[model samples]
Target chain A: MTDRWDLSTRLIEPAPDLLVAQPGRIVELAGMAGMGLTRIGYRMLSEASRRSPMAVVDVRGWASPAAAWEAGIDRDNLVIVRCAESSTWGQLVAALCEGVPTVYAEVPSAVRDRDLRRLAALIRARQVRVVLRPLRGELPGGIAHLRIRAVGVVWEGAEVGHGRLTHRRLVLEASGKGAAGMVRQIEVEDAGEDAVHVVSGVVSRASGRAG
Target chain B: MWFPAWSLGRPDAPAEGAVLVVDTKAGVVACSGVDSDVGPGMPRRQAEALCPDATVLIRDIGEEARRFEPVVCQVEELIPRVEVIEPGKLLIPVTGAVKYYGGEPEVVELLQGKMTAAGHDVRLGLADGPFAAEWAARIAEPGTPLVIEDTRRFLSTLDVGTLSGHDDIVSVFRWLGVTTLGSLADLPREAIASRFGAEGLDVHRLAHGQDRVVGPRPIPPELAVEATYEDPLESLDQLAFAAKATAARLMVGLHREGMSPFRVTTELEAADGTVRSRVWRSMSPFSESALADRVWWQARAWVDTGVIPGGVVRIRLDPSDLSGAGRQLGMFEDVMSQVEAERAFARAQAIVGPEAVLQAQPQGGRLPTEQVDWRQWGEPESKPERSTDDPWPGATPSPAPALIPPRPTRFEVEWEGGIPTRVRLGTRWEPVTTWAGPWRLTGRWWRDEESVDRYQIVTSAGAFLCTVGSDGTFLAGIYD
Candidate 1:
């Protein structure tokens, strides 16, 4: 069977633009700090909520509740676990291996490889899913069934007024077992408080590695 | 069901682009169009930061309700009895109507057809209870209805965070590691009751799908009560006493059917072959004593107005607009699964202290700290104080700082020739690779307070959204 699971297929009804995290697999969204990893995580949660109930584990306290609310994740459907330290990583991973469709977490760099493998193995055994978003470093090499990386960002700052950065072109690289290597650039424009307008594949490359 | 973007579709507003509805007082975007990721309860500044193309408008609660009136009226015609949950959401008990319409599918098709004919986009949800039905409708595709066959299994997989009733109970559930409705249902009932009280028990019942759902009360023809005086009553006292007994009998029967009417007609016949009748109405459902008092008043009015002459012989009480007096139950699953969690949570929050739980929303301010507002979760609605009409000059631009230290953490900026060349990040000093600003934001200059000069600096140690105040330099947030 293919490792990638299309989450929309399992929804009560089909919906578009939502990232699906299936049970019994680990998906890692790796990116540099400030590359909108948190924003992407929230977008996934928002879409997933429409399909099935889910929770978020903020191990590094990087997610802004205000931002999460704006991203369309219903506050009533979200359970935010504010991990005070890396010690609570085990507990969060355990929570993911339960019956939930998906669980989002910002995996701190300090987490041991043994712990991550154990978590991944448990998720596979229990038929649960995990979305690992690393805060500042490269995602741990092992345990990832899918890796989505933010390679570079091209930001457009407004020349007028206070010079706010209004638009961004984020180049992404996705690859993993059973997943074809592909490069897609997303147009990230401001829509509203919680909204990040994403038009996928402004630029694309077929089966390539990031330079 | 919930119309996620009902407020954004006014005739005057642009239909295609992103639209953001701001709650002025809190200064947050109350709602947004589906095309945009901006949801309700986001600050205007933050919303603008996320969606630059979005056209922002202040939310007009009156306009939303007024625009929705025609739709509600149209639905009431098809489904004899309909409950307005809110301006966009509605509930119609389909248990009896399902058989009439031939099945659940037909009922949905019938409603959808009528609503679509009326030039409105609508969806349908048919489940065992109102809670589940609303969710089924909300999550249903734009034109289809979601009919739930098994509510128990559907609710079991939902997050406990979706449980509505008491905010503290939900918060406690989160603290206790009860993440799903199934886990909550597995908890001992008495323990939940003793620890969280009636509100808690209600949530537990909802989780287990055991809520007491009192369906729509049908208007029975036998709701009226009558009385005949054995002898012709010559005085007003005799008529009053007779009316009192008849009203009591009517109330007992109405109560047995779990209904109370808002309006009742009282009829009286005089022994001399004269007749008098009048309709009595109350803002609330009529109680036994209140109904009797109204009946007595009708008799007195007839006698005073000379509408009736001689002795009174017969009296009757006819009730109309019979409404149910018990709670409705169905989906106790989380909001994503039920769609009624907000309303349920609002009610539960009222019983518990508001401050005990909170929901983050956007409010007006130039700085990150001033922009996002947090309110007590599920508090009574309040009119917004701030309007989006005013142009806020000197506010920092988009890509809001992800982390704003509860208190500013002092940071050193090695300044050379009035330009920041190097910045400090917790012991290690790194050269500024790329940077923007020295955005001079001068406000409230008349008052002697700490003013700010902000800058966005990118260093090797993650980009920093920092501010320089009169007191010292502070880290506003990290882009990460």
Candidate 2:
């Protein structure tokens, strides 16, 4: 029943109209995933800072799998690691916050049943949205996020208007790895906890509910 | 004895527009067409056409009020209840002014002396009614006051043009065979009203010696706020007071219209006739305190830097193009916090240099890195980082660097199959991942000699790194 609810049928790709606040078409810049996280995440985080002086993180160097609980930061506002080349599929799944609409770069690797449930918990508790790409490094035994995919995004009839959904700053769901989330939907702007609740809960509801 | 009204487009002026000013009482004064400066005392139309290069600055009621505010202040110091028509005109209800300044002519002389010293060509006129006084001022001799003792007799000899209001009045007068105020006066007031409407009745009243204030003119409570300086403001402290007063008055005036200015234009009129103006813009529409703070900061910046001198004779704060309530905040905000980023930036700019503060912008380009220009905050910074994100397609997942040093690094390359087989990473020729090859990089080759070819390789030392140019592959970056 749980697998049916979130059958991993869709590939975790960057949301099309990535700028769009709603969970619309999930697709990534085709070639970007291969470029690795350390190179791109830094620039994106810095760019987001200039857009609206919020926070940024670089989680590609998670060092090892257990770094998540050990990484000493506010659990609520952690940005997920985005270094696809470094992080495994299992590591990325552990990073995602279930149903929370927090932004993540990509699932780390082919996650196990327990790790997937962990990702689902984050989604349910915090509303996480991972901008995962299907591309893998062109290596003999390269681990690709696209290998273990999710169902394609369901846009339904999301109307484009200025509302709660479009105004939320992204909650970066860092799986023990330290990837930073880039919040550019840029609404409901106050830089602390109140802002995050509005971002994840209210904005998620608005985007989730809009026809 | 005429004032030259310059609207720079008159014939004597260049192809560029000139100035035009008209003196009503002088019968005729020199008119310089927008381009022409035809001496003095010329007809308006002729002067305008003669130069054909002048642009006419119409009588700005507000500007006139502003220009004459100092004169009013000076007179207000010497008299009470000064009536202002503005734009080079005023009336001192002299029945009391005469008593205060030792009779009419002497008061007129004192007023004239003050205005003359203040650098104005003043004409004094005395009469019971405001209209009569103004008319007398216009026609009064250069050094003489035009005293219209008998209002009726004095006005009777005046030409019909003096009735000067609407075409309807002129047409009605033509029908009634009344060319002058003298003929108009002969008509009964009741009859003029019944025949030509209330305005004609007004004309008949004006024609008679019975023109009263007629219920104080409906002053728009003030359409704008203006301030005048007693002395040239040579210090930011002095400008602060003037700026505060102007902003407070402006905000109050706009409050009536339920609006505020997001962008305000400050026009600094220099003593030597140079007008320095600039518009200050903000992301969120500001409060009066915030605006004044910005203005003070702007003035401080101007003072700190030598943009404007301490010798600013007059500073006019104009809230032009004000917006309504609830304007949404812009993306690149000017730090709504108390930290005041723009002020700091301005200070940093002034002290170090204007171009000292810079922002990293990503613009569209193909080079491993395309564009990065210096910008200040609150300005929309362009994002060119995406193009550089993954510039190469099949090059073994080589993530490119956002910033490259000034010179292109040289490297020694060895190939396996068609891909770059080996690269001299830091010191020695190291074996490379043969699968991902050919990181095509093309930049200012014509401009510089450092055009590059990149390769993403998993080295024998077990490092996944991006290598560029046969120059020196100094750990462009590592992946897993």
Candidate 3:
């Protein structure tokens, strides 16, 4: 765990004025919790920010784009946490307990022991935003956050509604400005809890409001 | 087409038996047979051509791996010190197994017996080196044995083609005038290795009786139970029962081995002749009952939702992320049930009548009578939070009625504005006891009709109920 007095520099990309000069790179996040958290180690120094607030930027050094994003962490201004293959789960976890946000990102399925404990600590923290990617299969159980993508309908005027409600077919190049590494066309659909239940009319109306 | 034994024929030996090895994209899939004869060639295609009536199965390498699985389990069962060389192969240090079984021949007999009991016919060969034993197995006839002490003389009599044994490698050795194992070993080991790389030296070392021991096979995480049916499983129930039995056996096996599986993977071989696979995970060190339940539930879930189609023949269990003890548990059924239920319910509702169902929901309001309503299932906004903490305004503390009228009642006001002294009940005159101010439940203002104002009231009979003023007072519902 880190002392509150420890100063952390965050790296941000074309971000908030306070975030721009920070020591971390700000990448646009598309999905919810789990998948997003795995990116802290490669993109941001979420692991480093735990022992100390110091970090580095080396996305190009990563073999996998997701790994780069995992390194570009949160909590300490999304600094890149460089870790060797020998890095133990305990180290990343200490950073997570220190309020590191992306510590939960990209947990290997083979994770065990200390890594599992670190995951528990991060989940208990609850303040760290989770990363989300659309599950290729039926959504896995115990997912705290759900993100869905689908191609929506085009209007009579060919004007695609630009809102969380409308999902469109966006052709993402293998290499692009907003590429999520995958070259497939992802239907950018509505995400979050409310979007999932809105059309079902499950939400209760305010007493005074007419239905 | 299934198991055909006719593929084991030799060129000179009449086609009395078969040993078929089919080349796959990555590796080889082999099966042996004694009755049906295969002409000389790769046992697979040649056997198919020879025995048209044979069970011509496209060998599943996975099945071969599964078949080989018991060997590992058997060796580990008897000889505590055995090293695994992939799924179907293993290397024993021999010092221990030979010592324990009294001799290498007895150990070989025990191994052969176990494999035979498991429905396999195995050839036993013992030599100082792993390669020599392997080659001896190829050359040995069924039921005969080879002892490690006589390995030098036995190996010398063997053809040099037995060194690599692979057709391509054997042909090369044969072309170089190498006729016997003794002759191949006579060449300089260094020169042979540099020319043919490490394989040549390995063959030479094996040809001579060199022994370099490796450790015994490490025990699997826990009990891994698998089953292969002689016939395809037709019904989901049978498949589930098989899965449960297999899981139970696997658990017993693990317990006997003094280990526990942290995670369990139960693979269901498709029963309907279709290769459908389903895997289920356990929350804890799953017991037979727990694992069986999961397997049965998963099978039923698949059946109900049509996740897997027609037929299946086998199931495998591979428990990964192994730990001896103190494995962390994640909820299995809670999550599994939700997924299962969603799919099952949707399918059931799809087949039956969606409009036939209804959900009784409590409507929150000041009036105790207006606290509940009914909505058809699948319609929007069916239920809301209705708790006792919030009290209704007009309705008395009396219990509310059950039935609701299709429309509300309209009252003529005797007093100045909205409050009425006299109100007409559903077809008769009645006086209001505990009257609450009217709360309008209005909707679709764009349309002329379908507007409402609900009121809470406690009748003089101490009944707490709600009635709306649309036309005339009709008993809606009573609070219980």
Candidate 4:
């Protein structure tokens, strides 16, 4: 019989290829309200939830569970905390990082610098992946390991009084420590029936940007 | 023992002759001061129709459990280890008590006398096992005690429907012509196991009067968590805080040992050397929050009824009935990490209010908002009111909007030839380049709600899911 019970001989590796941001690091999805930041965030959360339990800190009560389900996140393994106050965002996110492998939180309007440093240290210690969605265009300083900005979007399968929005192509630019300088164009097709496909690849690299 | 009409018999229940009915979302759970036509499990509306003047109140389980604490305390004076099955029902091994009190009749008489003196009407039953004893109690009169000498023979005479908590299995047995416990017990054990699997085997054992023996394993002295206060805790808040910490420590210790306790003893000592303790039982292993809730319930009951003489000085928790940790993780689940996360979530719940921390499960609804059910963290997940299996005709097609505003945001739409040309978004006008129309959504017409036309519009800025109703155009959500 095979030694199935012997865990000491098992090879363990952190899932690096799953997301652009590495474990124990902060990844920011910065954009305006309707610029598809939440869409990208949900996609990342979906991938993260496949590996371990994940949490979402909805500051403005804008995290839609239905959309998240459509985006392929495991509803059973997800916990959504609705917190409107900005002052407690640091403590709440840190608390979530302790239990969940991935903590996807909406950045409040203003975050104190002390909270950022505390969160960064805790993430390193716990090896928890943190994804920050700054929908109102306010970005935290210096702590983010990688920042993916939504530059533009192109809606497909729709025209003047014609078909519905079956799919769309999103343009994302990645920078900071993790990605250096890479631009990726991804196609997010929502073909009804609770199915969504994200075809993504690195399309190009920026010339002057440096980590 | 069983206390009939427990829900309607609370100290704060409505006065007699009021025809009170306690109900939940499902239906009427209990009733009192009413006729047989208004029985439990009947729909609330039908029960109300039967007794027109009845007072209907929602069931408060916590209140029922809290009120039952006094009876539990009364029984504890004679029996050391009383296992409470629910607010109305409890079990205690009578071998030692019977010997101490001289006989079965004497023990029952003593228990009945004590409870009656305390103004509680209870039924006592003495038998070989809990199942038989409970049925005996159910059939016994208020003062009279039911004692069964032969457990198997007594159980054999009862209908198979008497098997509580296994309704589906019992129904199947009834369908298969096994109508009585006698018939079920006569069936081959191996055949029962082959037909019904493990659950059937359990039923077969119960039919033969072989119910599980309530023998709580002796816990290690080191596993007991205790905290002594320098100053006696004067307030309920102080006691609750202490209980939370003590429960957490006990849970951590149990988790480390890869064991969980199904039975726990909560003991509190007063400043005047007065001691009170209660044994709490759970069908599954007790989590940190659950154990803490039990301690709080017991403490509040004692304080509210003036049973505790003075400020409490010490709080201790002793866990028994140890079993392998009941948490069965999935193939890819990391146990240590999951445990750590659960502890962290508990901490987070404390930081924010418990109500603020929520978990979502998919439910049925046409609108995106109604498709998900949100429950507070740590509470058992309830079945959705509507199942997703139903074909909701007017339901929104996937993918759902990423951002649903707490309330719909009104927007001014500029139209050209009945098509939206531009939309006013937060003091700026953005021209809509492409659009999809008017998925007509009708509200529950019986409630007199108006219908609306929902549109999906893609502007230069981003995508918007808006509704155009008689009132005006409102931004329902953003496809961000």
lDDT of 1: 0.62
- iRMS, all models: 7.9, 18.3, 26.8, 6.3
Q: Candidate 4's residue-wise lDDT over B1-480, tens digit each?
A: 888778787666668664554554446777887877778777777788788878777776667777888788778889878987677788887889988989998998898888788777788888987788998898888888889889899999999998865788999999999999999999999999999976787778888998754445556789989999889887987887788878888877777766678788889888888888888877556878888888877777776676676888889999867853344456787766766777777777877878888887888887777888888887766556679999988776666888887787787899877799899878889988888877899977888878998888997667888889888998878888
Best DockQ among the predictions, by candidate number = 4
Off by over 4 Å in 1: A1-25, A50-54, A69-79, A96-102, A109-114, A121-130, A136-142, A158-162, A181-211, B1-358, B375-393, B424-436, B440-448, B458-463
Native interface contact recovery, all models: 0.14, 0.03, 0.00, 0.76
State the TM-score for model 4. Answer: 0.84
Task: Judging by lDDT, tell me the better candidate of 1 and 2.
Answer: 1
Docking class of 3: incorrect
* First chain TM-score for all predictions: 0.73, 0.27, 0.31, 0.80
List, for all models, the DockQ compared with the true complex. Answer: 0.07, 0.04, 0.02, 0.38
The C-alpha lDDT values of all candidates are 0.62, 0.42, 0.40, 0.76
Order the candidates by DockQ, highest first — what do you get? 4, 1, 2, 3
Shift of residue A83 alpha carbon in model 2, Å: 49
lDDT of 1 by residue, A1-211 (tens): 0112222222122212324455565677887665655655666556565555455665544455655665566654554455546765665556434545556777887888788778878878866556788765656665776676766544444322235444443445566652434443333443335455444333233456532
Q: Which segments of model 3 are wrong by more than 4 Å?
A: A1-211, B1-43, B64-75, B84-90, B109-120, B163-172, B211-480
